[model samples]
Target: MPNMGRKLRVGMVGGGGPANFFGGPHRRGILIDNSAELTAGALRSNPDDAIASARDLFFTRGYGDWRSMIAEEAKRDDGIDYVTIVTPNDAHFGPAVAAAEAGMGVLCEKPLVMNLDEARTLHQAVKTAGVPFVVAYTYTAFPMVMMARHMVADGKVGEVRKVEAWYPQGWLAGSRESTADAAGQKQASWRVDPSKSGASGCGGDIGTHAYEFVRFVAGLTATRVRARLKTFVPGRALDDDFTVLADLDNGGVATIAASQVTIGAQNDNGFRVVGTEGTLEWSITDHNNLKYYRAGEPVHVYRLGGMYNYFPSTITPFIRVPEGHPEGFHEAMANLHRCLEWQIRAKLGEQVPDHMHLPGIADGVAGMAFLDAAVRSGRQDGEWVDVEPVG
Candidate 1:
């Protein structure tokens, strides 16, 4: 592995469109980390919109079609090292596959593809190409969340016994009222449509986030799941809420839920894990503090970038300041960018920094399996369904 003086050239596939809320944040993350540059992109599914977004986003070049971007970029002397896919659920697989086939590494948004089959195929393609690939499970990059994972893995929480996680949003509480207008209607349209977003709706969108959070923190795999899924709004095309009970491989249990109809809650994503000796709790709303408890002792607060006697090596870089400066969502996203940058550097034959690891293909496969099994279990009236382990 050799270090190069220049930054990695990058291209994007579906980030510029009406459907993007996190696209701007992702762009900012890249610049903040000093990892890569937006060299080119096929920014939207629509050709005109793609060209317009490229200029607005300041890409050096733009393409109406993703395949054209790949073909042209691959022929350049200074080619793009990575391509990011930030499209709707159904659009992820094609661009990712094209990017991989063109000999570029990839970072794709969550719920890897529309279904388990697509996920498996994409996973295989990345593996066969031997490219550095990552699924953007954004919460895994949070500093406090990383601290919580370190605590559990270091045996500070003892043997994990149970876990609970949820993500509640109020956006879809009254679908008619929310999507009655054209703007809201467009935003809510493709998400609920099966052809574009796949089988499960809210679960595929946010429930996977909750499930991924628990698995990442607890270091456990769910072996079986029983779920209840429902669509609370009339005429809504997909399930907006879900409750799932998971049987872990380590003989533990996890309860998970996600809903867009939880009124008054906005991005309330959090989780709690209990073990034989103590418990760990953290949430997105309170991004900087992690609550830890031990039996018969006062609760301990582990502030972000705080001096702690037991902090692990993997969590330190994300901490920019001493205790209480408040590193929030952007920092979490920047951490992910830093990790991907290091991995891309490694792929280009450079030495990667020690703390540069993020979730990869395996995590995406697991997410898909969880989604499929949960939907199956729910449809079967909460009967327990065995989740096939992804190797």
Candidate 2:
């Protein structure tokens, strides 16, 4: 893309309040490339708190709510070029649709929205507006993850046969909602509340990550799913653990599972894709490396920076650091923001490369479809159910 010669202005919805753990990361990620500036925010639902939070973060302007921010920002010549949505699951649809309709690019956090219907609607809104849109499927932006996608597409793993992806987080293993202090309560409360977090909490929250990982890396699509959702915490309104068995489109099968109730597991997200020729494995725990296995050969471990020469030409430019330097969550996030920045510039008539490996509306809709299928199957006692054709 052509250099715009100036930083793009950014707005935000949610990501405010003292207890929000996600907001700061989004902010830090957006600024990491120095390609964008945080200009405005509807930081909180409360008017005064919103303004106070924005001021604290040094945002140029703030509004009482997302609607107002979108409305007012649309009228300004120096308005935000895009909006980053860090809101809860339930709040995603409205601001995302409104921002797109107002011609602002959207970078939204996942599970996209509460349901597949909302996901499609938001998808249409962005399509109609022709604004750059990105769903924050953060892991897909990791350098190793991108390399895996390249390898799979290059037929390095041959035809995928079995995919196993799992994410286990221990934060909600016990009753943190009732027993922990204020910050813990604030984080755990909404996630366990159906009205706020939507159906199948753990499934929608982290399970989608595993599902998306399989899709992005293995290039496989799940045609149907048999799932079991469990709420281990006695009074939790949503599932804290879930397992899904899916039939892949290529006559392969997949096992995707997630648990917030897994003791000693802290973001232990991993995936293994077995193909006709070999197996490719990755884990967020070792975010920078990937392991390739063959029956008669020793395992080949590829580190992020060291694999630059081995990565496809299309992806080598996205590798940000030197060899042996570690890149983690923040770098992955910044990669997403960098893609968004390039996309935003492209929307301004700059010529960008034809392919940018960032997740967009379709990926968002796919996530919702997976969640819907999983929930339906779980309700039917793990009976097989077709994934909705919505995206």
Candidate 3:
């Protein structure tokens, strides 16, 4: 079949209205390049909302059942070539496993699944199916983030020693307000529900991002974790605040925190990696700049721009606009999308870029392992627990 000169067809799952969770970002990211088509979707759990969401995004006929969407799309002559899972944390496993089993490319939201067991199953399925798979660790997609990764790899931060990383939000500061109510928008309602979001709330939701950032920038693999998890809200089933101390594979140390109950800490996410020679820091608070400090040298600021002319050549294509123009969340997602686009093409026997930087199945499995270890450590009153090795 001649599939040249055509955008890859996509089916999206669970990016519905009144809920701007991963679904929205995933859709926007996939469509940002105009190199992919959103031809089908199972946009919501409610049939009416699903229809409305699909029509709003101009996706053809939304289906309430994600499995139905996948099955029907598979049988079509011009069915979706791949599927993106943008549902809640607990909802990712089924769609992703089904997609892989059906031999379709799959892109999934992070904390890959609810637990380590699911992570292992999904990882195995995707590997055995020989399908392209990715876990959406969107922060690493940022240009400066990639630059930081490049710098660490090139020995800019000499011999990683210690790392501090966190993602904290005050939206859930109070015991009374829901995320949707607090944000006045489509926020994660199921985040505080254990059944929906799994054991650890804030950690699974955003702590993985922090841990992933540390790994991405510091070039360290976590080997073990000692953690304390807390639930501040009166009736919440999951931990909304967590602090973890981790040992990295390279003999480095990390202090990680992710909390939704922190007062006045809206989306304060970032990391600082300290090595034998220096330290590097970046955060969403200063979304466009990265802080670099070497022991004897003055602190330096790096921005998202072409004119700055200090970054590596690999950083160029990720720059979306001029110097003064800032690139933030959407661009990061789009960057991953662009990489995945070429990745999908590579599977189709077309030559594209080499060594894609997007987080893959192993990363996802590792993330889940980190979560499992943290929870275990917390249960034992901050006892150090080894992160399970995955092959």
Candidate 4:
């Protein structure tokens, strides 16, 4: 790869408040390897708060909103090379489309937009602008996840038959917005609102992660879905629980489930891939290890960064440290940022390895399609619905 020598400049949108859950992770992820620098941002929806927050964070420049940020940045000689959007679901489409239209790279959080139509429109904007775009499917960036993906591709698990992916959290076991005393809950406030969270809350929030996880590891496209989405929390507007049975393009079946109401579960994102020859099991709680099972062989655990010569070459770049050192969420996020940096460099005439991978507009569209199908299926009383294809 060609060395630009200087770090890629980044601008951020949303994730401004001190209590913002994902803002810090994104900032850390982009700067973790010194590959990118946070130079600008429109950090909050409130005009005054946005500027103050940006200044407090030592951003080179700040704007009250994303529009001014993009407009002014486009004119600067040392403008941001890309923008990372950590906004809520409803805020994603506008900035993403605007950034792409301005010919700047975009890295946006998933459940891409409010609806499939918005997703397709955003996709068109990206395609027309010819900018490098990435969706923050954070889990797939994990080295072990990449290893699992490669294992399936190499036929370590032959002809995938069945897949199961689930993401459960206990935070919404009770109403976070309903009670009179819950006013200080900033994160859950907008999340349970239909206008802000869109069609399905839990499904849009973490369920997209589970659905994408299945697609990434099993290398299967969800073709159809039969889904049930329900809101168990009293007076909540959006569904807090989601379950789906999906038909894969290869004729295999998958069960994808996610819930915020599952008591005692905390970020318990996991999956099982069953194939003709073997099975692969993995969970975020024990992120560094992957469990393998076959008919006649004993259960095996593949640890990340293990000095295993059998590990595929594709995953080598993702491993940041020696074996047993323990890399986790932040590291996984960094891996993604690294790939996105490489992609941006590649676009600017740098040579990049063919094996270097990053999920882009297509992945975003597919995720939206999954959410759309699931929502439609839910509305129709669990009737099967086909997932929209991504071109």
Candidate 5:
């Protein structure tokens, strides 16, 4: 807490070299609160790329490997208060576990690891280290999404009967020059590789985002699922399209789906929760708005601002701008980072609210369970698979 008035010093792991898809959003988002600084980075596997990224990001210096960076940074009096892991799936385990064991706070990209066991081990380490940790499940931090959660808890949607969620993108639609990615040329090339991305591709990537959205909004757990996963692209090692039917803990049901091969869909992530009284809808494409429907009333659209009479008062504090102007993905992520930063400050003896929380290790573990069960059910031809929640 010696640097209480200063920004939290942040060290980095891997993202991408030239420019990463994840790192930009994360850094932009965390800075939205002006709570953290990107003082150091180990941006890529190649030492040259890492150094180049450090220069581009204006870091104090770049190291060749995360272990070297972590160890050296730990020796500083103003050493990184936290580390951000933006590496790919296979690369997450070593650095994250090592950082937590080293007593540095960790905020990692999702899905937290390639497997649930890794998640459990990381969880244990964080607990023992007593450091704050979070997985970047960014969508849950959206203002409207939180409003949806507030509404569900308020029974604005009544008794939740069913939920439907899907994240469809057209990014992986066509054939790739197989050699281009192996030579480390383009973005997301590792996503289709089983060894690099994990067991299921589409479901593990965006599908888990949809799954988290459903649970976050509906405030219910899907204990089991019946799923089908498919790979449309030729010579692919994992799935690109997946659909799942889940049985909720409250006896409700959900249809969850995600696809990277949907032509023209373009990151269309959305969900609808149907309750006995009404239904709630939200889409990240139209992120600022949350639509609501009641049995005997007109549709109510709540924008992400205080001027809206329809929006609950709880949402006002999170609204950063005027009514018509929209808050976006960066803002959503910023909110999550803000919450996490507050928790870090609280840990450092600065007073902060107790109910402040974001998806942590248990949620990360549960996400792995979701992906694992989907793969298992897909293999067994749409059989039911149970999801035991974990961080």
Candidate 6:
């Protein structure tokens, strides 16, 4: 059970549309286990939309703007302990900065901000405010992924030699000749627009996830990268596909790719880590199962919720059921929310479980740096580009 001694008072920014489109999962996840409650929210960019969203979500206090939410909440003795930023890539910076300045912990959506400069500024702001900040990297919270991290960290896989990670989607594979003005088209609009989604579209949207996941599981950073980027869709403003060869800090190499134009493929995000001793492989489709290989031994498949002494103890709390009861994407997202809630409680001087520590601002910054460098490298004709190390 989550610690009920105190509920982390929470406020949300951007709940107007699909919460997942903004920051809904974080709010729902925190509230799920009774560890946190949604006290207030400035849910939309527009005043009417914000109020409507708040009422729909049943928030007690609703404000049209995030500034008002922060200001009003700060004056109360029982003010919100944390604020969640779920706005668009361009909109993430303002609310997050405001929340931090108001002395609130934050859990913002990934890609941190629209660009590297904004990411750096937000990082500095959070540090100056001295509050816990988390970036919503939903994949890292998966039980099996956590197990993989543990295995790699414990030398279960020995020294890492190579890694491969990719996220491919077929949603945008339509013929470009069929449509004009892809900008205003629902799915490809904001994403393909450089101004809204940043310099690279698919790279920033899902490629960053691939980069962060591999790094998290293997516990390494890319020192250099060589890449290619493409816009398969005709008349598209940004690259819809990206591929990269990364040089890892630990003398290992990684191949990373993300594409929105893979026809018939649906959410094919997966990774395989190879080491001197053995290998570990997993995919988003078969998220509950992780394959473990040891030289001269039959491969072992570990399933989530399975009773295995070899499983990492760090993931025990996240396992809610016995093995073979499938727990997939949404559950993984919930785990991140659970961790964020615990971290928020710890900040308020309340007891939090040991597994509360998840990827935070630093991880988000690293993801942004990866995107920035990858795009730059791709533009330079796959030249070896030194990735700016993010702390």
**Once superposed on the true structure, which residue ranges of model 3 sit more than 4 Å away at CA?**
1-4, 176-188, 307-309, 354-356
In Å, residue 318's CA in model 5 sits off its true spot by 3.4
Q: Which lDDT tens digits does candidate 6 get at residues 157-214?
A: 9999999999999877875424564422533566777777888888888898889877
Q: For candidate 2, which ten residues in a row score worst on lDDT?
A: 348-357
* Residues 349-384 of candidate 5: C-alpha lDDT, one tens digit per residue: 876543436678777877888888888899999988
lDDT of 4 by residue, 1-391 (tens): 3456678999999988865778899899998887789999999989999999999988889899999999999999899899999988999999999999888999999878889999999999999999989889899888888888888888988999999999999988887665554433667878888898888899999999998877788889899999999989878889999999999999999999999999999999989999999999999999999998999999999998747665676677677788879999998888877888888888888765555476788988999999999999999999999998988
Candidate 2 regions with alpha-carbon error over 4 angstroms: 351-355
TM-score of each: 0.95, 0.97, 0.93, 0.97, 0.93, 0.93
| Prediction 3 TM-score vs. true | 0.93
Using lDDT as the measure, what is the rank order of every candidate, best first? 2, 4, 1, 3, 5, 6
Tell me the lDDT of model 6 at 88: 61
TM-score of 2: 0.97
Name the regions of candidate 5 deviating beyond 4 angstroms: 1-4, 177-185, 306-317, 353-356, 389-391
C-alpha root-mean-square deviation, candidate 6? 2.5
Give the Å error, residue 214, model 4: 1.7
Query: Which residues of candidate 1, in runs, are more than 4 Å off?
Result: 1-4, 176-183, 306-310
Would you give me the overall lDDT of model 2? 0.88
Q: Which stretches of candidate 4 lie over 4 Å from their true place?
A: 1-3, 179-184
Instruction: Note the Cα lDDT for every prediction shown.
Output: 0.84, 0.88, 0.82, 0.88, 0.82, 0.81
**Of models 2 and 3, which has the larger lDDT?**
2
Clashing pairs in 4: none
